[model samples]
Structures are given as C-alpha cells and as structure tokens.
Target: MSTTTTAVINLDVPGPTISRHVYGHFAEHLGRCIYGGFWVGEDSDIPNEGGIRLDVVEALRALSIPNLRWPGGCFADDYHWRDGVGPREDRPRMVNSHWGDVVEDNSFGTHEFMKLCELLGAEPYVNGNVGSGTVREMSEWVEYLTRGDDSPMASLRREHGQDEPWKVPFFGIGNEAWGCGGNMDAQHYASLARQYGTYVRNHGENQVYKIAAGANVDDYTWTETLMKALSCLGCSRTPNNFFQGLSLHYYTHTGPWEDKGDATSFTREEYYLTMKRAARIEELVRGHAAIMDCYDPERTVGLIVDEWGTWWNVEEGTNPGFLYQQNTLRDALVATVHFDVFHAFADRVAMANIAQTVNVLQAMILTDPDSGALVLTPTYHVFEMNTGHHDAQQLPVHLKGDLPTREVEGSALNLLSASASTKGDTALVSLSNLDAEGPRTVVLDLRGRAVSAFSARLLGASDIQAHNTPEVPDAVAPVLHTGIRTHALGLEVDLPAHSYVTVSLELAP
Candidate 1:
C-alpha cells in the first residue's frame, strides 16, 4: 500500500528569500578534488582553461553554483598565500598533512583559484589560515585579493598578471577549529575568531562576510560562547561589522566514524540510519538559532553550514585519507532533504557549502583516473533540478494529516520531506521519499494562488545503491515524470521509494 501525505503551501504569504549562496560548493586541497579533479595542469591532455578544469566548471555553472570555498578544510590552517602566488613554477611545494600526506605542487595557487571562480561565474569564498598563520599574513592575503589601489599586496597581485582586484564575497575564518583546523575550546576559539576576523578588512568595496567556525554536531555551548562573546549589548556597535556569520560542520555517516559504511554496499538498516542523520540538521540548526536569538535577536549573524554531505568509506583501491565515496540514490535523497531543511529555515541559514566537490565525499562530478572521463553523480541531478529555488521567496509548507513513518532505533522517521519556493510567476516544490521499498503519494494543497498547469521531473533508480559511473553516467539521472495529476485541491504526485522529485507550476493570475 502506498502511503499518502498532504501539504498546504501558502504562496501569498512568502517568507524569507532563500539565499542562492545556500546552493554553494566546497573545493578543498585534498586528494583529486584540487589536483586531478579540478586542476589537471595546463600541459595535461584534459580540457582546461589556464590549468582549471573546464568540464567541471561548466557542469557546476549549469547548476548556477553561487560560491566556491577554496584551499582547505584543514589545509587552510597550514596554507600560506605567498607560496601560491607570483609564478607557478617558482611557487613552493608543501605537504598536505590533512589529506593522504600528499605533496602539493604550488601549481594551483591563489591566481588559479580566482581564475577558476571567474570561469564558473561563482563568487570566491576563501578560507583564511588561522590555526598556524599569523594575523599579519592573514591580513595581507585579504589586501592582496580585494585591494583595488596600488597597495603593497595589490601591487603584487598586478605583478602576477591579474590587473584588477577579484571580489571575495565570502570568507571563512577557519575550518573545524574544534577538531582538524585546531583543537581549541569554544571560549578560546571565539576570542581568536574576533581577533582574526578583526583584520579581515574590507578593501576597495569588497566587503567580505566573515564566518567564524562554530560547533560540531550538537555542541550548543560552542555556539553560545561565540554568540555571547561576539554580541554587543546596549551599544551602538553590532556584530556584523566584526563577523557576520558562524560555521557548522556536519556529515551524514551510516555507521560510526571509525567504520563509515560503504557508499554502495549499505544495508537497509544503514540506509535508514543515514537518512536519520541527515534529518538531524533541523535540530542542530534550531538549537544554534535559539542561542543566536538570545544574543543577536535581529538575526544579523548568519548560520553557515560550510561543511556537510555524506561521508562514507573510500572506494576500493582509493587513498583512505582522500575521503572519496560514490554518490548513490541514497546520497541524492540526502541532498534533497538538506535543501528542504535549508528552505524551512531560510531566515536563519544564510549559506551552505557541500563538504568537497569533485571526486571527494558526496561529489557532483567524478572523473576517471585513466581516461579523464567525467561522470555526473546522482546528487548532481538533484542540485540541477532544484536550481529554480535559488534566491526565490520561500513558500511556507504546512503538512497536515497522518504522515508516513519508518521505524529506526526506537524512533519514527518521517518518510516524506518537502519544501516549496516561488520565483516570479512560477513555483517550485521539491519532494523526497525516503522509504526504500515502497511508493508514496503526496497531494499538495496549493493555496493563495491558482495553478493552470504543472510539470514534474524525477531522479531515482530501481535500487537505492544504484549510482553513476564512467561507462553508465546516466544510471541515476533525472527524467520528466508523468505521474502527476490534477487533484481536487491542487495536484497529486506519485513518488517512488528513495527518490527526489521537483514540480514546476504555471500559476494563474
């Protein structure tokens, strides 16, 4: 029997506009993500633009990725901006102690990254080195990237051939300061964040949105400490001038961190567990937001989920430290659910960047090592399908009646997750069915607007473990869904198990 769920979308009463930056991506200096993934060298046979991978850029651009975070997850702490600029050949090589202990040839440095951003039309979100770097070094890097005048750092940028200063809209203070970035306590890191963020000045109209690293999974104390320290009471001074956002890092793993389940070989139990973990982001966001409300009630300080997505065991024969994993139907569902959560709390979550893009954990495009062939993963299709929601006014979705549920670990998990947003005259409603073995029916009770017609697209596979590969790239791709029908209230959608669907409505005036 197919379970049915009802949702009422209030279109006229629109909520906060979902920031397009929420659909952002992360590219770290780990494994093939930067080396063979995005940068194949100007001399290599792969198609590239000034050493930046053109295909990867084109694929990401198609999804309209708003921003790209560069350099490191942990590597940002050890990185020095000077080593990556000047001349590519003369740039110094350093060891990537964070990922596989691999030696990084300074070929893809600051200039190459900014150039890559330009090609993809994505705003640069550079993570500054704060763990091991001095304040002076961090300060100059900002001047080098955003200074338009002939300042010392800006002059050096011109010396490297970039005549104009590049715009950096987003800047991360550090990553995982509680763990990898630096093992600092909450209070200690909060103080350091204010200190480091102080010097990350705005140079020549390039105002950077500084995001300080916040808590891990459920450490509300870290968020509280940062909020209390950064928030000013009864004073004219505000928090945004110093730092505008706080960062949260969370990953959906099937099992314990010591033994993250295989991406394609997960059991039914593990699949549900992964979904349960993915759904917990709502709790984390609410908890952190509550703390922020106590401090900055105006919601000036944005919550940035800078590091997210699934983290499964590395594929066979791959380097363990690389954090490589296959993207399956399960992973795509995870992505959809996360987007729904982001939209529900659009007023709080200003931005979110999926962990690492390309050949890493929950990547969009996976490249073949031998032939350099590119394969678009299932998760990529989800992002491409939901592009309509970017910067759109969020429509409040109220789910009514008994919802479908799956039991896991003595608790019930809602099998249906949904969110809707409107841009112009069109509205996009995204739905996810988390059940692994049965179909589900969703009847959207559209309100405040009349819909003349609608179209739908679906991304799913016969099995939850199905994924894309070089030989069969479209194995889990999206296709136009014909199972939608006009309902008495609005419309009815039949969703397959472990699937994601997006409906586009032609609203009537």
Candidate 2:
C-alpha cells in the first residue's frame, strides 16, 4: 500500500538564504579523479581546453557548481605548491603515498587548477599543505596565487606564465589534521590553524575564507577545542577573525571501515542500513551546530562540511587505495536527503563539498580510463535538478501527517524526505522516497503563494542497483514526472520507491 504523507511548506515564512556554496564539489588528487577524470592533458584526444576536459566542465557547468575544492583531502598535507609551478616538464614527480603509491607528474598545479576553475565558473577553494609542509611554503603559495606583481611570489608566478593574480575565495588550513593531514590532537591542531591561517594573507583584492579542520564524526570536543582557540580576551583578534569556518568530515557507509559493503550488490536489509546511516547526517550536523552555538551565538563562524558522501568499497579489481565506487540510484537518494539537511541549516552550515566530482567516491561524473567516455551518474542528475535552489530563500517543510517510516536496527527511519526553496517567482521542491520496495503518495501543502502551474522530474530505476554505464548512460536519468495533480493548498504527487523527484512550481504573482 502507498502510504500518504503530507508536508506543509511555509513560503510566507522563509528562513535563511541557502548559500550556493552549500552545493560545492571537491576534486582531490586521488584515483582518476584528477589524472584521467578531470585533467586529461592538452595532448590527449579528449576534447579539452588547456588540459582540462571540456565535456566534464560542460556537464558540471549545467549544475552551476559554485565552488571547487582541490589538491588534496589527505594529499594536501604533503603537497608542496612550488613543485607544481613553472615549466610542466621541469616540475618534479612525487609518489602519491596516501593514494595508490602512484607517481604524480605535477602537471595539474595551481595555474592549471585556476584555469580550470575559470572555465567552470567555480570559485577555487585551495587546501594548503600542513601535515609535512612548512608555514613559509604555504604562505608563499597564497602570495603567489593572489598577490600583485610587486610581490616576489607573484613575480615568480608571472615568470611561469600567469601574470594576473587569481582570486582565492576559500582556503583550508589543513585537511583531517586528526588523521591523514596529521596525527595531532584537537588542541594541537587548533594552535597550528591559528598560526597557519594567520599567514594565509589577503593580497590586494583577493581575500581567502580560511577553513580550519574541526571534527571527524561525533567528536564535539574537536569543535570545542577549536572554538576555545578563538580566545581573544588578551588579544586584539576576535573569534570571527581567527578563522571564518570550521571543517567537518563525514562519509556514509554500511559495515566496518575495513569491510564496507559493496556499492551496487546489496541486500534489502543492507539498503535499509545504508539509508539509516545516510540519515544520520542531520544528527551529526545538528550536534556540531549546537556546539558552535555555545561558542558563537551570533553564528559568525560557519560550519564547513568539506568532506562528505557515500564511501563504499572499491569496485572489484580496482585499486584499493583509489577509493573508486559505482554511483547508483541509492547514491542519488543519499545526495537528495543531504541537500534537505543542508537547506534546513543554511544559517549555520556555510559550505559543503561532496567527497569528489568525478571517478571517486559517490562521484558525479565517471570517465572510462581507456576510451575517455564520460557517464553522468545518478548523483549528477540530483544536483542538476536542485540547481534552482541555489542561493534561494529556504522554506520550512513541516510534516503534518504521519511520516512514512520503517524499522531499521530497532529505530524508525523516515521513508520520505524533502526540502523547498524560492527564487524569484518560482519555487523548487526536492523530494525523495527512501523505501526500496514501496511507493509513496505525497501531498505538498504549499502555503503563502498561489501556484499557477507545476512541472516535475523523476529520477529512479527498476532496481536499486541501477547505474549509468558508458554504454547505457541514460539508464537512470530523470524523466518528466506525470504523477502530479494541483490542489487548493498546493499539489499532490506520487513518488516511486527508492526514487528522487523535483517539482518546479510557477508561483502566481
């Protein structure tokens, strides 16, 4: 039986404006995410502009990705910026010890990344090296990327070819200093952030929003330790001036870290377990936000969830360290619910980046190694559908009726998830049905505005394991949803099991 769930959206009373950066993407130097996925080299047969793949850029451009975080997750800690500048051939090669022990040719460096960001129209968020790098090295990098020609580092950049200084809107002190970035305690890492972030200077017009590494999962103390570091009792610096945002890293997966279940081949029970884990992000965000509230009640310091997404075991036969996983219909639902939470907490949560953009964990685009053929994953479709909500005013979604729920590990799991936002005269409503075997009837009680008409798009498949392959790229793509009807309060729609639907409401003036 299709359970009916009614969600009332108060358009009259809107909350914070959802920052478009909340839908940002991450591109680390892991697996083919950089080597073959994004940077295919200027010499390659793939249609590219200045070594960056044009197809991938075109696809992501449609999604209007606001910002792109780069260079490393863990790789940032060991990455030295100088080696990647100057002549491409003269640049030294180094082993990517953190990921696959493969050698990195240093072809895609600061200039290439900046050029790529220019092509994609995304603000660049550079993660500086701190794990094994010196403060001087990181400080020089900021000068090189943002200073005027008078600065020494900027002059060096001119010698390498880029005469104009690039604007760096976002910067990270380090990545996961608790583990891969460095094995330091929270207090120790917090001190380093103050020191490192202090020198991440604003050269002329380019100002960087420095993000400090915060907690791992449920480590509220990590946030507290960092917040405590902002003690300006004796100093001239205020808490807001110390660091603009604190970072959190979380990934959803089923089973132990050593034995995460397969991405596609999962049982009904495992699927439910995976959804239950994915749903815990709301709890995690709220936990960290509550801690932030205790310190900065004015909410000046933003919570940056820089690393997040589903981390499944690598596809069979793939390198274990590469962290490659197939993106499926299940992955789409995970992205859907995550956006809902991000929208709800738009005030506190400043920015977020999915684990990767291509050829990695819960990737948006997957490229074939041999053919260079690209396939847009189901997760990509969700981002494209939700693009309308970028920088839109968030509306409160209240569930008036009994929420469709299921028992997972002795806990009630919400089967229907949703978020809504308004931009100009139209409002975008994103909905997801998490049940793997059952459909849902959802009544959207839209208040505060009269809806003249509406159109919806649905993304789903016959099987939960449905994914887009190079040969069958459109297998799991979105189609115009015809299962919707208009009503006085709002609209009623039917959502399929394990599916994601987005409604575009044309609000009457």
Candidate 3:
C-alpha cells in the first residue's frame, strides 16, 4: 500500500494566553557565556553597558526577550550574592568548581546583571543559593535587591553605590535540587523550599515571585511530593506562603550527556530521534500539570520550565564544558515544536527560558569576540518569526482528522504541531511540519472567519543537517512567504518537509 499523509490546521480553536515570559532567555555564569559572549569590560574598545557587550544587548533586544534569568545554572547553589558586590578589585576571586575549574573574578554580580536587564528592557529572574547557603543568606539577598529602607541589607545596597533598590520580582529559591543543586529528595527539597521561601521577604512595591525547584523530565514522583508538601504548607493555619511557581528542567537531546549528538551534522535517524525528544516536552508538561491538578484543583500554582533547549555535543576543538554548538534547521524545528506545546498548556505553563542564551546549547546568538562578528542562529529566527504569539489571546483550533504519529517503544507522538493567536484585526497561525521526508499540504480551516489578506514565512532546509555559518549566513533563515490566501472556507498551504511556517491573516469586515 502506498503511504499518504496530510495535516489539517484549524484556526478557529485557540490555545491558552501565551505568557510574555515564554520568550525569555537564560544567562548563566558558566563557560564563556557571560565573560566572552556578553561581557567585554567597560574599558575595552567593544561598546558596553557596565562591561556587558552592547552588540550582544542589541541582538537580544531584537528577539524582544521578555525576561533574562541570571547567575548560575548549577553555579546558583554555590554563589554568594555578597561576593559579587562592592569594588571589582575588592571582590574575591573564586574557582568555578562546577563549570571549568577556572578562577572567576566576580566582576559580573547582581548589580551588573540587573543593569544588563535594564539595558535590554527585560525582567530579571534571580536564582538564589540554597544548597550551601543559610536561610539568612537567601533572605538578605532578597532584601539587598528589593529592600529600600534603613535595614542592614538595604544599607549595604546603598553603600555599594545604588541608593535605590532594584526591582527584582522573580526569585528562585534553588535550582535542580536532585543534582548539582544539593543531592536531596523531593521531600527534603520541599522542606528546604518552605524554609527559604518563608524568609524571602518582599519589601517595597516589588511583588516577589518565589519559585521552588521542581521535577526533572518524567520524574512524576517529585512533582507529587512537591504538590502534597506545598499543599500542606498552603493549608497551614498560621498563614504561611511557600512558593509561587514550581521550576522544571528538561533538555532535548538524542544521546547521553557524554555522547550527545553533533549539532551541525546528523543522519536522518538522528534528526528523527532529536525531534522525537523535542516533542516529548508536550507529554512532560501534560504529565506535570496532571500532578498539579490533583493537589491544587484551583490551578493556583504555576508551572515554570525554567531551563529547556537542545543540548548536544560540543563543536570540534571547542571546550566540551563550554557547550558551544552550531544551530541549524533541526534546532529551529525543535524550538517551534516546543513553543507550540507550551502554548497548548499556557494556562499552567506560565514561563520558560531557553537554556544558556548565547554561544551554548541551541543558542540564539553566537559571537566571535576576536573578529567582532555577531550572528543569530536558526533558533533565533524561530523566535523572531513566532513573536506574534507573545501576549496574544489563544484562539481555539480543531483538527478533523488524525495527525500522523511517530512510534517509539510502544509510544507515539503526533507528527504535526500548531497554535493560533488573535490580536486587534489580525489573526496569526504558527505550525510545525515535523515530518522527515515529503512535504505535507495542510488545509487551514478558518471556520468561516472573514479573511481579507494573508501571508506566511517559512524556515526550512533541503537537508536536516543544513546550517548557517559566518560565511553563509542565510543558509537556513526564514523566507518571506506569499503562498496561502484566505477563502470563504479557509486557507491552504504546503508545508515543506521539516519546516516551521507562520501565517498571518487580516480579518475581513
């Protein structure tokens, strides 16, 4: 029998309201991501804002990044906020034991990070040290940032130069409690979260968002323990508040950490497997939400996938710890699929940050500091292409037929993913064609919605391994699409194989 496949996208059914934080990026003090990639020192020829590279800032601004998470991934637990304050020379030089074992000068501290956020017009989501630090340490850190009074920490903040307190709303109690962030069980971490959260005071007009370290991928037991424990905390007659959001971390990679697949070159099987892992995020979010539902049926708690993206083997000759990998159409496809999934569960998944913003796993920006060359990766294109979904009301979509599914070990994942949004008189539809081989023509059923004009943009490559380099910058960028139009029934567009397409339509009068 000859095989035939098609995709049907319904623009009538919308998803949840997409959070602005979904467009967030992460900047950790690991590898060269901060020093070489972003920070170039104020004295250098490279234009900078308090030592942060201006070129890098402009590039991130183009992405309209909503928020930037800072100061550690695994390093957050080991960091002491005080060490990063005061004079640059007076600051202690500490060895980064988790990352490269290199000495860090503590130049880029809390002040520098908030300054960078301000320059980019992005919100700061600071992760606190809980594994090695005390409750006083975490509480004082919060006071130093948000407190604007004569308190000890606030006084210290003035003494440092900033007389006024910074506006830092999002604070993570800890990160990855199961691994580098203190080897503790869910119950242990939950108790630790409660203690740290109780002391994390919100001074001034800034509202604090306390995030608890949540489960890894598919670790349902952790979520179950967290929900049950936090529920008890919520039910406390003493009136105590513990957490505002639960943080989850997951990476989409085909092989083990040591043997992660190459970023630029891969066979069809590898591409298929990588996308399979990417699509699993939908299942992960749904499963985590199910646990949250059992405990908090009112949906008061938020699910924050704080760390996510494609993690693969490092580029040739690059330091493995540096996590420098080439971005390609494959990564672009991965981003589209993940974003669509997040939108589907937008009510529960409030925020998510791509892992290691620049010069790291599936990075949106890559820099050659020596040559002063800055390049946006394929993943960046995906973000720019789908920016319409940011803060847009989710429109419901209905698919009449079954979308093809890929089977893995007796499990299956839908081949096509889609989401829709409407703002003002314009309706936007973004879809991902996850099929590896032939193109799929999707009949976009608009459900009798008046459509005046329509246009589309597509990011795809002839081969799955196709990538853009400094020499060939436009290898896999988005092409301005003009194929589909609005009819009385709907619209029809042919989605190229392994492509992400965004269609914008003008509502008719």
Predicted candidate 3 versus true structure: per-residue lDDT over 281-393, tens digit per residue: 98899999988877776677889999999998888988767888898898988998888888888889889999878887878888875776788888999989877888887
TM-score, model 2 to reference: 0.98
- State the lDDT of candidate 2 residue by residue for 393-488, as single tens digits: 998888868688899989999888999999888899989999998999889998888888899999999999999999999989999999999766
Candidate 1 error regions (>4 Å): 232-237
Q: Rank the candidates by TM-score, best first.
A: 1, 2, 3
Better of 1 and 3 by lDDT: 1
| Residue 282 displacement in candidate 1 (angstroms) | 0.8
Clashing pairs in 3: 12-396, 13-395, 13-396, 13-397, 14-395, 14-396, 14-397
Residue-by-residue lDDT tens digits, candidate 1, 107-184: 888999998999989999999988898889989999999999989999999999988998998888888889888899
TM-score comparison, 2 vs 3, better candidate: 2
Which 10 consecutive residues of model 1 have the lowest summed lDDT? 232-241
Q: Which stretches of candidate 3 lie over 4 Å from their true place?
A: 1-15, 232-240, 408-411
Error in Å for residue 383 of model 3: 0.9
